[model samples]
Target: MLDPLRNQSVIFDFIEKEEYFAIHAPRQTGKTTLLHELAHRLNKEGNYISVVFS
Candidate 1:
């Protein structure tokens, strides 16, 4: 949504390194939204099979 602009590279870095992290924010602060976007990116890469349990 809203064509995510910032979190892509950051999330990709973490996912690339297989590092674990969490998106923390009060409700409706784009936590789930970002996670879904990140999950989509990871899935489309065709390199890492991923899931987001938001």
Candidate 2:
């Protein structure tokens, strides 16, 4: 679920700190959906500009 990404403290820390990072995972694991959702949320929060390059 979305919690899997939203609840990742390290990830939020990295994003909050503006640190460069990457998310690696196998195929069909909801990576894209997660990213889009994250971007939407982040944008809605009016903090960062999140985009998915694919």
Candidate 3:
């Protein structure tokens, strides 16, 4: 499994800027996993509220 946080530098920038964004990819491409990991990390840091809608 890939480390969902390592290659997502730009996502952090988006979050910092409070920009809205969406993840698009083929099925089974780890989109959900990435979102879950991102939310986990953000919540763990205690600086933001992250929720997964799907």
Candidate 4:
């Protein structure tokens, strides 16, 4: 489920650097899914706790 995001180096770099960022896109474009996937991965890494609220 996280495969697409897993392969995005830029996104990984942003996360690895602990930088603040946002994902903006038109409706029905997977913004929420990406955030959920990111939160799941971040939690699995045990380095940070990520959450999504919408």
Best by TM-score: 3
Q: Considering lDDT, which of the candidate structures 2 and 3 is the better prediction for this target? A: 3
* Stretch of 10 with least lDDT, candidate 2: 1-10
lDDT of 4 by residue, 1-54 (tens): 334555456677887897867666678777677777777888898988877786
lDDT of each: 0.70, 0.72, 0.80, 0.71
Model 3 superposed RMSD (Cα): 2.3
Segments in model 4 whose C-alpha atoms lie over 4 Å from true places = 1-3, 6-8
Model 2 agreement with the true structure over 1-54: per-residue lDDT tens digits: 335555456667878887977877787777677777777778888977777787
What is the lDDT for 33 in model 3? 85
TM-score of 2: 0.70
Candidate 1 segments exceeding 4 Å error: 1-3
TM-score-best of 2 and 3: 3
Query: Model 3 off-target regions past 4 Å?
Result: 1-3
Q: Please estimate how well model 4 matches the true structure, expressed as its whole-model Cα lDDT.
A: 0.71
> Per-residue lDDT of 1-54 in model 3, one digit per residue for the tens?
545566467688889998987777778878888888888888999999888884
Model 3 CA lDDT for position 5 = 64
